[model samples]
Target chain A: MEISYRDMITVLHGMGFGVLFMLAFSGAIGVIYATAVVGPHWPRSKWDNAMFRFYLISMAALAWLATISGAYIIYPWYRAVPPAGTADLSTYPRALLLSNPHTAGWHDVGMEWKEHIAWFTPIAMTMVAYVFIKYGPRLALHRQMRNAVLGFTAVAFFSTAVAGLFGAFLNKYAPVRGGPDIVLMREN
Target chain B: MSVEQQPTGSGAAAILAAGMGSLALGVFAFAGDAVPALGRAFTFWQPTGALSGVTITAIAVWLISWFVLSRRWASRDVRLGPVNAAAFAMLAAALLLTFPPVMDALQGK
Candidate 1:
């Protein structure tokens, strides 16, 4: 098996960081809901509080990593302009999609939307993490604040879902597929 | 801080600032797409095109607003009802404004 360096980085950005961040949402929402909605009835300890803080902080970090890597690392490669009269546009995912009528919408709609919308995830999640950490279990006492936090978290999830869906579809249609090859295994 | 003693202002600041940050991103993105000059202006990084500038500016807006609002409201208990309503409205606007179709419609494209 072999994979190009670019492909590897794309996988890490999409699966390693993006999907992992999305998965973290389930745990985050559940815990936050339990803490805020269930209130004092839920069992609590200093350890639990500390662990939740770490969890939220980690999620925020993952969100930042995903968007940063996507924007700075992989995106440059994906959107690189092909030199004049370049026959093969495969290396440029954006151009490759735009060159074809059928796939044009994938770039116009999918990439255009994904590029901007994905950002909201990090911004929203960072606030959620900070607010939760700042208030801790005391968040349960402030009903409106709790509702706002939950609403923001939900929006973060929605933003992530939109970005992730488009990212997956874009890769499937026009993959970012170049760079030095790294051989994983040599078949005899 | 104890439940009774904790101030909601800090949390409110964060929430409102996130909403504002999101709104800034949407506005910047819409302007960048609609106006060619604005698009070129937002190309702070050549490789990433306008995206680099758009996100950086939005983040700066978010952080600065958060800092200013937090400093002002940290100690006091601010009303959250209006704040939540405003924040959620901005969040919704951000979602719509980032969408290409919605952007296209607004631009009469």
Candidate 2:
């Protein structure tokens, strides 16, 4: 079946949003697992270590992919419009993707901070995964480094959570998509 | 050393694996956007298609990393602080420089 740009765009957005949610979920698990493994006499299993590292590496990588696809959908809208908060309310009350601001606010300013903040997702997650692996066996031994890793992981996790919130919000409202010379969708 | 004390593989392998994994994601996902020809090159449906691509890449990275890291271990304890740190630093640098915004800035007058 031929897919409209709307379907494709929506699907891509959902893909990124869903994957970001997964990333956050996996990241939370990672931090928990890492924390659990740390401390005296904690049972240490090599395979378990491998499993943890695998989770981190794979999730981080997948996050990058999702973000890339998400950007693919967003970039055109991002560039085609004027700066956020500067849009002409009368002519274009919302950004390119909003038929109206009430329902699908995410298509407008809802996504503004998300678009920019989303950049940090892959960067931070990749680092978090690396730290977990490099210090796989030593995390508990070094308190400061352990805390640092936890902090960074939290940030990455938080970032993914934010992306997910925007996604869920945007998707929930099923907002009208609009842009230069376009009005793909709008809720009455 | 006990099995518990020794991690299954060398830290270096895991480091490289993460980097390779991230790169795989970058190639598969970002290419479609940055280069229109590449995106159109394959008729991948959104979401599902994209998920499949990333899954393949993630599995490949895991297998390759495990194999390489295990082989490198070769019955010795390997503390990966310096080497892994170096690899992580390199990947971070590459990500920083190649990220879209930075790339755009570099190209713009």
Candidate 3:
């Protein structure tokens, strides 16, 4: 098995960070809902509270890592302009998609929307983490604050879902490929 | 602090600041996409193009606003009704502004 450097990084960005972050949402929402909605009946000791805070903070960190890597690392490669009159545009994912009318929307709508909307995830998630950490069990006492936290969490999930969906489809249509091949194994 | 003694101001500040940050990002992104000059100006890093500046600036706006608001409201209990309304409105606007179709329609494209 072998994989190129670019492909490896792309997979890490989307699968490692992005998908992991999305998967964490279910546990996060469940715990948060239990704490806020179920109120004092949730059976959270100090240890449980500490663990939940750590989980939320980690989610926020994952969100930051995903978007940062996408924007700074993978995006530059994806948007790299091909050399003049280049026959092969495979190295430039953005250009490859734009060059064909059938796939142009993938770049126009998919990339443009994904790149920008994905950012909302980190911003909203950070707030959700901070608010939850600050209020904890007390959140149930403040109905408005609890509502705001829940609302932002839902929005963050929606933003992430949109970005993740587009990312998967974009890669399917015009993948970011080309780099030094790293061989994993060779048949004798 | 007990649950009754805990103030809501700090949480409110964080919420409002997030909304502000979201709005800042949407506005910067929309402007960068619609205006060539602004787009070029926002290119702080050549490799990443305008995105580098847009995200960094929005983060700065978020953190700064959060710090300022937190400092001012840390111990006080502020009315959340108006704050929640304003923050949610901005959040909705940010969502709409970042959508390409909405942006295109507003730009008459």
Error of 1 at A89 (Å): 1.2
Task: Report lDDT (Cα) of residue A16, candidate 1.
Answer: 98
Q: Residue A94 of model 2: what lDDT?
A: 33
lDDT of 3 by residue, B1-109 (tens): 2344489999999999999999999999899989989999989999999988888998999999999999999999998888889889999999998899998998899
On residues A35-128, what C-alpha lDDT tens digit does candidate 3 reach at each position?
A: 6667754535777788889999999999999999999999999999999999898888999999999999988888998999999999999999
Per-residue lDDT for A45-112 in model 1, tens only?
77888898999999999999999999999999989999999999989899999999999999899999
Give candidate 3 regions above 4 Å deviation. Answer: A41-43, B1-4
Instruction: Give lDDT tens digits, candidate 1, residues B1-109.
Output: 2344488889999999999999999999999999999999999999999999899999999999999999999999999999999999998999899999999999998
Error at A132, model 1, angstroms: 0.7
Order of the predicted models by DockQ, top scorer first: 1, 3, 2
Clashing pairs in 3: none
Name the candidate that leads on lDDT. Answer: 1
Off by over 4 Å in 2: A1-9, A12-43, A77-108, A171-188, B1-109
lDDT digits (tens) for residues A26-72 of candidate 2: 54555545554656223267777787778777767777776766656
Give the candidate number with the greatest TM-score. Answer: 1
Q: What ranking emerges by lDDT with the best candidate at the front? A: 1, 3, 2
Q: Which ten residues in a row have the lowest lDDT in candidate 1 chain A?
A: A35-44
Off by over 4 Å in 1: A41-43, B1-4
